[model samples]
Target: MEVIAIQKSAFDGMKNELKELLEMTEKVTRKYTPIFKAEKWLDNQEVCLMMNITKRTLQTYKDKGLLPYSKLNRKNYYKLTDVQALLEAGQPYNTDGNGFTDQ
Candidate 1:
């Protein structure tokens, strides 16, 4: 009877430890899941989609200084903020500082 009690106690302790491990894993996953607000920047594919351009077109824009981008480990990245600024500046509806219009 004592041996059975010892075995049951060990199994209970193991089960409790496994449950704690699973709870910890759940917490870690929730902490690291991606949040949409944290990812406003555009990668190459995102920029292509935004501008309706091909990868080659994006390269040309980068080469011509017409697009804003950054290099991370030799890979290019763009920001939505820069795209918005470019669109605003190029729009015909935009006015100069002196209130003069392009039209």
Candidate 2:
């Protein structure tokens, strides 16, 4: 019947539209997704962004032992909690070894 044929055509069109929509969504998600390195450690660039500090400043903290970090094959990683503590502290530039100042 013509009605049956029309229904089948509509169903096929809807199926194709759904497939296209899914593909589009996949592309969009891929575009927005962050690509992470395999090191499983945050690099200096990421640390600077998180702590709102210059890379040299982060290096200074690292050198002074004020910021605790882990080393993975020459790469450094600061814990999220450490970064949060640093933000909450609002201390001066010098590392007194006290770790985090009261804001």
Clashes of each: 0, 0
> Which RMSD values do the candidates have, in order?
12.2, 12.3
What TM-score would you give candidate 1 relative to the actual structure? 0.46
How do the residues 57-81 of candidate 1 rate in per-residue lDDT, one tens digit apiece? 6676687687878776688778788
lDDT of 2 at 62: 85
For candidate 2, lDDT tens digit of each residue in 9-98? Answer: 899999999999999999977864543232244677888887766766787788877788877668887766677777788634833345
Q: Which ten residues in a row have the lowest lDDT in candidate 2?
A: 94-103
TM-score for each prediction?
A: 0.46, 0.48
Instruction: After the best TM-score superposition of candidate 1, give how far the Cα of residue 43 lies from its true spot, in angstroms.
Output: 0.6
Q: What is the Cα-based lDDT of residue 22 in candidate 1?
A: 100
Clashes of 1: 0
Among these predicted structures, which one has the highest lDDT?
A: 2
